[model samples]
Target: MLIETMSIVRDIPNLNQLSKQRLDWLLAIKQQDFNTLAAMCYQSHVIPYAMIRQLRLPKSNHYEKMLPSYIIQQVNIKNITEKDQVWLLSNFDALVTTQECIIFCEELINTFNKGRTPKLILQLIQDKCLPTQNETYWYSLQEKTKDILKKQFMISSYYELTAISRILSHENTELDLGFEDHERRQIHSRTMFWSNYSSRFNRVRALLPNEIYRYIETKLKRLSPQIECFDQDGNQEQSEVFIFELSNIIVVEFLRGELSETRFFKNTEWNAKRLFDDKRLSSAAIREMSQMEVHDHLSTWQYFCEKLLRQKLQVKPNDNLPYFKGLPPAVNTYDAKIGLPKPAHNFLSERALKLERWVELFWSAEFKTSKYGHQSGLQLKSNLYLSKALIAKQLDNYEEYELFIKKAANQGNPEAMWQLGKSMLLNRKSDAKIRKYGEEWIGKAASFGHVEAVELATRFKLAFIPYKVSSSITNNDETDIKTKNMEQEKAANEGDLDAMYQLGRRSLLKKGDLLSDRLVAERWIAKAAILGHEDALKLAIKFKLPFVKKK
Candidate 1:
């Protein structure tokens, strides 16, 4: 497929935005062909969900159904050599432990790459207590050989990038599983791997010179990313694509020791603060640093890698950081196109238009005034706002975060309320400011029974009663609280045992209701017990309320 003739593939983060049945229509369009995917293979973080959704499309063609498998088979593992195969079968160990072999195998077979016999054999011996264990094998390796092993592990990390590329090809399917449980496990593994190992990222600063890297998290984002080619050019033609452009520039700046600090950390010195502020260096960084220092990701990786990164940034090798050798380079061939040149397309624009329509409806004064008449759709919109807020928060875009979170909170969203309250109180004192802006929102969220919000409210002493305490709750002129009180009293008087029990419990929380007195609470529960409310009977016994004798 020629690059120029190919239609540039705009980003489509999720195909499920439309029903699965529509994938056939997309496949029929023939726009997302092999060559049109403009984003370099590394920036394909948005491909998995698209792949999984395509796999779920019921009317998938023969080509579509078998694509994931076909892509995996493209990598001829047989070229790994007989000796290497025998070593894996006989004694060679992978970066993952024997105990973790099952998890690693699932990761390989179910999602990333599978159908290799050596990998299967390796999995088979995971529980067999091999004579040459992973620890033993690693410890026995020559320093050079150990470096090689580390490199191999790094190679394995790109497996997902390859799979995602095949997905973006829009020409493939998973051999066995698409985005099922095992795929989720792999996502979790990758996230943990990145988060747990970031401190020692300098150990493999070698990889920084490479064309691409994967985004650390974003397992469930609709228009998310996966792979990013840090050196790719001319990708920011559209205003929306600046994110991709800037992310790569950051990588470049970081690698060249030209990394600048964000304004938030301007008060801190670059000498010791850059890596900690990186929100976890990559997990691979930690592992490599640990491998070099003879300690683990959390320990030596933290202690030594910080110094190494600092020295590198400071532009002088002070002595300690100049010596450590990370593991060897990866044996696997990176088949992904490092910098596939192309332009933007309308695929994403079309989706963006659809999203724009929804956004307009959400923000329009007329639409906001008119009932949307759909609870599920409204909830989805609220959640979308919340998700945007979270993504904005990650990027330190306070304006977008505030805008989205406030929109969601105004819709009575508990999560938005919780987040909003947290934001207000995050660094501010528990003074009049919190009471004015933060406490009430947190209280509203807790009143809606959001457990985390409830906890936060309690933790910060921000909680307030949502319902007004009146002389007679059942007759009070407030909103729903009065209606609920009226309904409970009516049902209790009408001998509804469940309602009777609820009224009894409500009486204990406030002394102004129809059943407000403790004596009345006991009476109602006792009556409910006689009327066959088992829970009421239990409550009576537990509280020793007139129906059971005190032991």
Candidate 2:
């Protein structure tokens, strides 16, 4: 199945392999409706070009980026074949799409002026290529306005942000309505809510596919919750990567949803994950976020400055087309900059609540929100306490750090159990005390897949070789546990329900991420649910994990 999924993505025409893989995972889960699938494919198709533009800004200028469009305009190859033009339009490059859309609209206007309205053909193109609402959203199409709606929808469709910006900047035949700008106003007023084409996705949550939105959001949860500071061990790379990944994810899954009510920090890596346990600190974070971008004693684009710059930096696909007939621009390959977030601000706008939760745990002494607040949706994740213990120690609060470590151990955190046990081994005065507590806690940790705990327990005569400590194996150290994982893999490959049950538990160790690959882990757990692994089944059902096929 995995190989089959890989093959599906590999066959996509021009997308790079990495992008194809990302899009494949996002797209492989069949939605049952081809319209939804088409929307997903279209979004996935557009993001690479969007990312390329974001990446190109730091080192280049507008002229360099506009090179592609300039060449197309200048080269006047009057006898270009229709087949060649179709291929050029289908390049899937943002700049190429923009130019083609313009040319297409112009040709349509010309044909209309020649006394022919290809309404059927235009309607098909609008239905397929335009960014549009899901069919369910249109409550009713009035009999009187249906014809006008079609025309307005056609004039409203555009290929890129650049296209909209260009059309709005000045008068052009493509944007002009029979040489009058009044058509633009009429098209904007005719749409359901948007006053402009670029604003179509601004309120897209209503049109987004529910299942895909939840799925991508689940992935986003895994990537978020990192701590970032400008000078310290900041999460600049992770935050940047996340912003890039998220924009692509939303466009493909959530339809470029709004951020006016979301955390503004979503796009910025600098001080992104700062804790605001302190009131002064919370105020400080808000102030920093509120501050506008400044350049050499001048306020430029204000809070929007970074977003503007990145859009400018993106590599335009104008001259890079193969048919242009020249060595590719000296630099700016799609590989060099595409979908990387230099500045994450274009996608952000609300206050982050995650850091407050981190701070809540950070202050073990406070122990606020004793059993978890339902409103916050914060849960005690596996190894979370152990991670907090490490942070506590870093803050030099060793006294409370031990307390936090023990808390994690009590919560069945394998790392905490193993670590607390190791600490006892070194600190306890008597051998009996050392052996008693050390073996107990480490044994518990070993049951959850702590390899070192397994080795330690084995050396202390508390466990056997291969460490099959649970009814389900936990330690996944291939060297020692290879036979078991292989056996499970074999049984799983052959569709053995019992094997899936065991593998699911094994993959679901609450000790560490080293044991967790949520997609694979969830799949195993979901498979086991069919065989009735009680806890695994509960979570699988809750998460709506995909059920694997039986042999």
Candidate 3:
């Protein structure tokens, strides 16, 4: 049955493979359709049997990183036709399908944009898989695939697949309509979260599928019995059925209660295990998790932003589309930037409290230290600042919040500078007082590689926002000049788009007795402009400069 199932998939169009043994197995199998082969591969223990017989686990825990071995089993090229091979090559990428609202894998229907043959397609996917390390070569393969999808296939659909891949990889798939660049970063962060989360679960002998969300949803809907438990001290606390729904993931958290520890089993051949196991979680961790849950609300905000941005401009994300450079800002400083705080809505506030309770329970510090201790000084100061800022925001005290921002910014926190910049830039009046602080905040944040800061500074041509420049004496001092120069140099090395624009403007306008090489400054600014800096775009159009845009 296994051999017959494998054979059908081997013959499926766009399923690239060739091995004599696999061909023999295919000839032996009775299955003839791609769907049947896929079903057999999924339902039977064929792949698991192959893994046990043919492969050894790597020294490290590679189970979580493992791929389905059906792809790795030996195959024969003699039976595969040239046309069949071409079809396989054309549809080499994976596709996601749904059966009765349950997600499953299906043969990807390729629209051959890359012009690569089936043989080449096999080589590409193979190249993406390393002999040893799993993280060895992901981005490069993703980039190559993205290029092909953009130039040849339907770009939009390709992006949807990419997004699906992210969810499969258990990465955050927050789609941001307002800020694509900002949201793309969260995807990487989500990948990190999954890696860490899986590693933690693996230590306790808990077997997890690659896609936890989909698996959990399917299992619960099928009435697969799973047990949940809480960890307290050493002796087993209790366990209960992990009854959850497919709609929302809130079921995962609904499992806390008192029950006797006992063995339980269901229709599926599986053993019950403790949800958290013997792992001793801390309160600090719980707090951080709670904070993250709060932040997850940003996903909805991101989706809305994507819709708004796409409608305002003819931009489609899947086309490997670079952001527009010279297009007049549809979203300007005047746009409403804030989202409603969860505490404002009663329903949201209830959920927030539950998440917060879990966080505080898991992350409570076991010990406390004296405030006067030198080791605790920095921690104390930062905490004080954080507490004050939180209070100010809670009371809707913008003035106090602004002061806290200045204090933190002066102490060199990029996040503080970013907050300050946002506040001043959004204010209606735009007072001299606010402008001075805002420019200072923007430059400081930009110098440190803050994304929003870079955006703001480049949009407005402010060289150095006049601030309380920390110094021994007055603003005219040489030390201040040296510091500013060093800051600019550092920012330039870090590829600050606004810094380049500033350099170009200063070079072109040569104010004071200060002089810089015109050619070098022009080169820097032109580079920035070419890379989609708004100021650079405006300057390029103004001076009628000629330069090709870098991909």
Candidate 4:
């Protein structure tokens, strides 16, 4: 009855393609009739082979004993698809005896050599099948894999290196071949070690002999004059210092040459042409040579040159070089005594050290302040101090930040003034005198055309109006107040909207009966609103007055 049912379903297109003999084999496999399949295997291997390829057999070990014989007898290695091979390899432990599995793996290796099988099959054989075997078996498979990779490397073209690299660099497990350690070392080597070739070939480079490394170095040196054979010592610290010194010299020379050639420096007023031309200029002269506009350019050039030098020298960038002593030793060393101030040197990173060195070298305050016009000197000094203030802030050195920012502000740096003002104002617990000082600095910054400071000053001015009015009323005698009110009333009667708004605002602050004050304030604001004063109009609306503006 089941056979009859299968026959009905077998008329579908997939089953329709099979011949009657194959159809009978498929039906037998579905029915789990191993005895019939064994009998069918005796007649011809076709039905057994077709069953293995087309049918999804049960994976239980019950059929394990029977399936290996069918597979050995029915399947031909050259005729099966790689998918079929993978499946067979995956279940090879159950499908074949240990000896037969070895033979199957050898066949798969031969298939791989002929480029007919993927490396995954070999990986599966190595990872899944061989690990449980005895030591001899495991070592034998590892040796075979190693030999295959070595032979491939010897003959592999540039394009074929990736395939070999993948086979060697399995993520799940490292292949026991000699290349893994070498690949790792190459991975952690200076990026310049593989600078001659694409980084994609790093694994391949590890496979290269010393002769190839020498050849690459020779070629690199021949191509690039700046590149030197500095890697022999393998002291990365020394190499870093060498490169740093070289880059600094190059930057200094390049900047000097640029300044000497610049037409701006040749002007009679600057008198800087001779200063730039001196080969043995003092450090003071060097700092004087730098202008505010060239600071960014100098930084960019130094970075680019340093990177290029490191790449050429086959050295990695070492941020933690204890050997580098270009600058004087930091005197901020700690003392063990309790209650003494701790030094900030421990908190300064390598970047902060370099920033300090840069400020000391090129941006120091030793320049002639009156040589290149007073304003230019002050502007340059302000920028340099601002740079120092930013670095100090980054290091959380509040004292240094305040000191440098004050210097910059005294030099008329608007940004520094604004920053100082904002910092002072942010300290809400400060006394009124400090607050007023902060507000005065903000006003100064606004006068210097700082945009944010301008907006902030307008808000501060409006917010301080009531305070100013109340303070004046409190400080002045009744005679003085009466005279001020009379002058304000006289100005308001002449249609001065500012005077009208002030009068209205002053009435609202008079500290009397609330109803009378509001009524008096509303009348003055309404009169001002009639004259198209924006603030008076807003105040009138806020008071809920019934006044309309004139067209």
Candidate 5:
């Protein structure tokens, strides 16, 4: 019955960027005052059909397959002729309670028998109850009928039923029951016992053996339908002595669940120390210490002692037993090198030449350390350069980007150094810094075999080429002029402070389509501050810039 309704699409903050064409179409409907509402499609940048199709009354012409609006919103839907309602009730289990309330239980049962909508059977079983004839009628019977319903219809022993009762009660209606005095007491005790049993059983499942579930199933079968009761003599009695024998099997199952297959440990935390502190297990230990004898994976003596404790007292587990005492100490016998490291061999090989220096520097020290780790340093510097470079490039301020690149590279940052040299050469300024630092940078980078710098140097006729500029660049006028003026300065005329300031702040604001670079961003911001750009100066003061703030 599942059907795809809407495809996930681009992010749309609101309805603002919905295409003009789509908007115009929707506006036409709005102006006509049709029963239409326009909103962004759930999980899409585009609008869905303008009409609220689900709210439309079902017509012979309407497609049966289209999802109803109420259904899409997961609301309880009851819109149809009585005959149609009865037919639907007979075919779908999701509407079982709705059918029962509407006096169509026979139809619902027929639907269940036909095997249509089998997935909804569990939901129906869990929510089964009396029908809601009228709210006023139920209110009149609140005191009188509440008792009768609690005894007959609300006696389910299942956990899901108990949870559903709490939910139904909040809506202030009864399916078949109200909270009667004895039933209230029964519910309190049942909830307590159920919570306790579930908690311990879950913990046991987490710690126990896989095969032990079979043993438990066999044991549960052997016991009386009623697990515990008192006889006329007021002695706490059991139909079988099997409960006493269950400890070894339960403990085995618990340990297996914790150490092996993970299916049993679902939604439970497994801890050895907290399992020891349980009072029930302590009492059981005192009793079973002399008699029961069974043994398995007690690699640690602590585990053995805890197992023995459980056997002696025949302790019935409760909710609090599994709360952890603390973290277990590392097992000295277990090898730490069981799992393979990440950054696969293929991935490393592909980037080995480009990432050689970064790899060495990043791995030189343990990643997790108390003080400034190399990994932390690299992460911080990489982010910084990327942001600055992006901003400077966006503002067309290549000079500032060059400075930021130098600072990042001097800190052993290959990416930053590569960016700095690349920006200087590309912008065609090629000043002394480009020659002095650029040559040294390209050499250091190529030594480590950084592919990006090598590729650029090989293709461009710059004085600082790590290897020969490619054959294509040697004959080209554009590259030849660049090579000849590889050390030209681009400054302004003397006394023209505005032009001088602009020259100093050339790449302060990047222009055109380029990605953000932190180094470039910082450089532009810094250059503008040096020229007394008010906003830039304030930013410098705020961030406590390394050199300019003091000045």
Candidate 6:
């Protein structure tokens, strides 16, 4: 009779819904009949929690798989045992659906509020469930859980802020907007978001209460001392990167109007009078000064400045700005004479002056301590000089621009060499001697593997020799040239675009039969063009190679 009943129950379509026969069959199975009960549960597609507990069935992998469905379908949160809750929490990834996980997390939080162990809830948050196709819903759930953790002091405010900043950064789809129209719209939206502080503040207050705001503010206020501690404890480099990101957030908030000038200034002063005295320093300068490490930090600051400048000037993302390209704009144009409008001009001027002061401060310290022995100090000095030169060019201060560029170039800064060389070559009234000097500078820059300088040198038929190559090896010069050509040929065959371009350029520059040289140059340059080398593509088009059709 029991076997006949089990067969009947198996034929039913909705055995997952508990019925009288299913319940009776489960009860009728003796405690020793564990296999029979398990079989019934498996066939029914349900496992009643009470029956499993009473029968002392082991929480096997099979049971764990079935448990999620049972919890979602039948278990009462209030009556669920701690052991079962632990099992459910531990196997959260086993939940068949995101909806099921969401339901379980909400219930767990409710349980947490009603005197359950906080550690369990915290652990659940730490082991976040796998995300689903619905990224928006998943990110929302993550933020909600993090907020709960923040409020309960399970996580630090700094941790929460970092998480929030990361989320915000991901939300900006600047890179994903591939089309010009979409990019413009995104930039406009970003501009609006940054310009409207009141709306931003209101949204923040809506999501996080005033107390949380005050807590974050207090933590930020105390960050300076903590950074100093990090420095003293030999984590200076790490601390400097941290301060760069932190100050970035603070400055962004101030620009957005979420933070007042006083609060922003207080948080970023870094005990530097040049930053705050008479408000001479721009926000970017102040932030730059607050950092301890000089390496790569200037590049970071420059990138940040570009973002801000794009927004302020409403410049399209792809608009090739001369400032960033290390080339000053045409003489006396709107950009060259005054690279920025009045407001941007004032900002950049302040920033340039502040950087100048930074170089002076470092020089003074080095002189006092006799610490000029380190290569890093000299590198830092060169980088600072280069930065100052770029700003001076933007501000149209030609004398200061030349002064700083020469200083950096003298220190073997390749970029400064390229810039100074390009400036000299582009000068309308440059004498033949000046042009020769400029070509030498460009050749030096090319030896340093400067891409643009190499392209420029190639166009001018200059030899691609390394700056360190000894001129006294007159007897072996031809042999060296042959060896270098062989190496370049090997690299080109191995698919190096730069090598291909160099070989093509060398072929074009050769004093040989024009027809044969043209074919050789076209063959190598065309290969590079097919591989997406920009200069190679241009050169290929200029040569009118048969494979390259005119647009």
Q: What is the TM-score of each candidate against the true structure?
A: 0.25, 0.25, 0.30, 0.27, 0.19, 0.37
lDDT of 4 by residue, 252-316 (tens): 22112112111111111122222323333333343344332222222112232233334433333
RMSD of 3: 19.1
What tens digits encode model 2's per-residue C-alpha lDDT throughout 267-382?
A: 22222222222212322133233221211101111122223223532212222332211112332122212412222332221111232254444333122323221112122543
- Poorly placed runs, candidate 5 (over 4 Å): 1-388, 391-403, 431-440, 459-551
Better of 1 and 6 by TM-score: 6
Give the total clashing residue pairs for model 2. 11
Give the alpha carbon lDDT tens digit for every residue of 1-551 in model 1: 43333233323446454443334334433654422221211123223234445445433343333222222222336565544344333222322244343333333333323334455444543333221242222322223433333443332222222233223222122332233443343323322323222322331111211221232222211212323332333421110000011110111112111111111111112211222333333322221221111111211122222333233232122223222222112211111221111112343344334443443442342223222222345655775687567545533458978999999888767789888887777645567776467777888887765656655555666755633344453433345555667876876786666668777755543325553377788888888877667667766765666664223
Candidate 5 structure quality by residue, lDDT tens digits, 171-209: 232222333343333323323323323323311211112
For TM-score, candidate 3 versus 6, the one ahead is 6
Error of 6 at 119 (Å): 34
Please state the error at residue 377 of candidate 5 in Å.
Answer: 5.6
How many clashes in each candidate? 20, 11, 25, 0, 48, 0
**Which segments of model 4 are wrong by more than 4 Å?**
1-354, 362-375, 462-551
Put down candidate 3 lDDT per residue, 1-551, tens digits, no spaces.
76536646565666433343345333423333333332333333244233223223222223211222222222223344555444333223332122311111111112233234355444543444221234323222334443453344322221222222243323232332222444344433333322211211211112122233244344332211122122343433221112211111111221112211111111110111112332433222222221111222122223222333234322223222232221223321121233112223444344434533432332222113221122233433543454355435544566777677667666666667777777787788999888787887788777655545655676686554423323444444555456666766666667766667766755543324234476666777788888877777766665566766677
- The lDDT per prediction is 0.39, 0.39, 0.38, 0.47, 0.34, 0.47
Write candidate 6's Cα lDDT for 394-446 as tens digits.
55788999999999888877889899888888899899999888988898888
Compute the lDDT of residue 198 as modeled in candidate 4: 25
Off by over 4 Å in 2: 1-387, 394-396, 410-412, 423-437, 447-452, 463-551
Better of 1 and 3 by lDDT: 1
